[model samples]
Target: MAPNDSAQTTEEAKDLVAGRRRATRYIVPVAVAGVAAATIGLVPALAASGDPDLPKITAQELIEKMAASDTQQLSGTVKINTDLGIPSLGGLAELGGGSLAPGGERGESGSAASPDGKLLELASGSHTLRVAADGPDKQKVSILEDTAEYSVIHNSGEVWAYDSASNEAFHAKDDGSGTGPGKEREAAPKDLPTTPKELADEALKAADETTSVTVGGTAQVAGRDAYQLVIKPKQSGSTVGSIKIAVDAKNGVPLKFTLTPSSGGKAAIDAGFTKVDFSKPAASTFDFTPPKGAKVTEADELEKEKGLERGAKNHEDFKGMEDFQGLNIIGEGWTSIAKIEMPGGEGIGAPKDGEVPPEAEKFLNALGDQVDGKFGSGTVFKTRLVNALMTDDGKVYVGAVTKDALVKAANEGK
Candidate 1:
């Protein structure tokens, strides 16, 4: 190959890798939230240690056990391993990814390394979290990063989030009623999902659809015996091969979770507890006083300064599916492709000048292969589990399905 051609190929290879990261960060949280995040080549031997002999339980019984779990107080160390299978954006995180790739109509700004993009930071790589909850009113989660710590604590009506790297803290006061938009906004992403119980809840909800549920046997988790709840989609369109949640044999709390993609060699997601305690964490665990030098921001004050209505602005955010026009679910069950309209009737549009931004072009080119069909030409972002088709016609058809499945869904919609 020519030198220029070789160099161009190398750049495309990098873009492909980074674009996959962006896609997984942007899509998996929404698409595979119930199944698992877009896991790539992380855990080569992530399968359970060994299958232990345990009393057999029916799928319904296992479901009931998980649903009936009422352990409201506990603390644990959660280890999360995942790979988005895309290249790292390197510096393109500021390409307005926080809000746009997140599938939001609202605009928000942040660079990839900034703490403001904490939630987006969960998109790739491995993560370790310290999570504790005392019933519903008192909860705390600390994301332990390499050089920084991101902690959020909710004690009664006060919610405090502190980012050690940035030396900034944010506070929000809840209604104490533990419900409504305030509650939703506080716990939605701020908690940063630290336990298998969290994903297990979503998986069980998927079971409500056309899925098969069974017990895959028992295994050891956090030094406790756990029954593996195996869930598989009954349709071929879904890219998810199978889901396994290990439930505490005695209490039913999900102790470990794994998701195997349809094209899997090893499991994509392998999250489990390294240590756990059922005892209520000390009162100090939920208490927070911003460090001496940390700059603090109050949610209410910010809303007031911006002249934004709490009820209205927050309601729009949660009403994403309803407010995001042209979004439709094509097909049924786990194979469903959520069709979301590209913002501004453009494919990651640039300014009003009518030109594709260079960064945006690179982002798309790196994300996936180009395809042409009755649905027209578009980019297909592929991972182990989820595939998203960003059509030339300002629409995105995404789901845990194959590239062909996305095309078919787009065509069927057309």
Candidate 2:
């Protein structure tokens, strides 16, 4: 995105918006900004130091500066921390039938990245990411772990996601989908937020009626002087308290992004760089060669192998729920709730059939609490910023709003 003062820049901004919509499905949209209706996963970052000395700038100006930023080459270390307040992260993997991990479908043994893996890894705790970019077509993001690394590389229109521990890789061709690694994000697990800009882009997507934007002040992020652009929701019922994007004072690039929950203690999601470099990374940084023993899975092969497993999905793995009917959006803007129908039985119970495993059943029982409302009784999963209500009839309502909001949406169908 660039300065919308000119026609060229306006077009670029629209393009950026469209490009971003295509590139992402995650970090847990949490009924926030219409990112997802099923579940919201917030990506957190390390906190920045106190405010810094900088020239005064308005919120609109900072947004413009960030949109106009054109940093095409850079390398940096990004720290991702998320605490959605949900317990038993390993239960999430079992819910997915062990398909959640990036490339470790090989067996049910070993650490496997996470019990807990790939997308699950980004859902909580702290992760160190090595990121680099040279122009729109070349870039790399690597998640460094104790004994393994997961990486996503885009070079000359080819995309590769490799998991070192699993010794497996996923490969795809860009096909001119869109600029930024997110264009094909839904297809691969590593398409998560690796930079402040990526997470900040989500906040920018808020509808005008739902957002109130302002300049929070100045700060130093990754040693760079930056301006904080704060966005808050206008309506009631949203789980998000506010979003703060730290924009580099000089380059206009976003240096950090944090989303504080309305119930607020600590930020539910905080993401930013601890170290950064604007200079281009060496060409070798994007060059990737699969290890000899690595199993390479092509994009098409992966898609066919795993249906709906490519992205974070609702709990439809329960027995007798064959197809995920679809989603219904209730209300609008920040207060909106996402309604989806699950075709199975009254409750997420031990399946009479083997469609779901024992662990998944156990997870479902533990993750939610039994509750009854005007709409009826099912279960509810509550976190700092989002609430979910699964009705007895198999209707699921998710939103950043309160549990009452979800129940209201279920009853009124509004």
Question: Model-by-model lDDT, in order?
Answer: 0.74, 0.73
The segments of candidate 2 whose C-alpha lies over 4 angstroms from its true place after superposition are 1-50, 88-91, 98-104, 107-117, 177-207, 301-325, 342-366
- Considering only N, C-alpha and C atoms within 3 Å, which residue pairs clash in candidate 2? 23-182, 27-41, 28-41, 30-40, 44-81, 44-269, 44-270, 45-270, 45-271
Score residue 21 of candidate 2 by CA lDDT. 79
- What's the TM-score of each model vs. the native? 0.71, 0.69
| lDDT against true structure, model 2 | 0.73
Q: State the lDDT of candidate 2 residue by residue for 1-414, as single tens digits.
A: 355469888788799998887667553454465554322433223343357888888665676677557788989999887878876455655655545564334342223422225666577777888999998778898899889888889898788888887787777887755454445644443555334444345545544567888888888888888898888889887888999998899999898889999887888889999999999799999999878977777776555555455334535344334565667888888888888875554344223335668787677768777787766676788987789887766677889997677767777862
User: lDDT of candidate 1?
Assistant: 0.74
lDDT of 2 at 188: 46
Q: List the residue pairs that clash in candidate 1.
A: 17-86, 17-87, 18-87, 18-88, 20-86, 21-86, 239-400
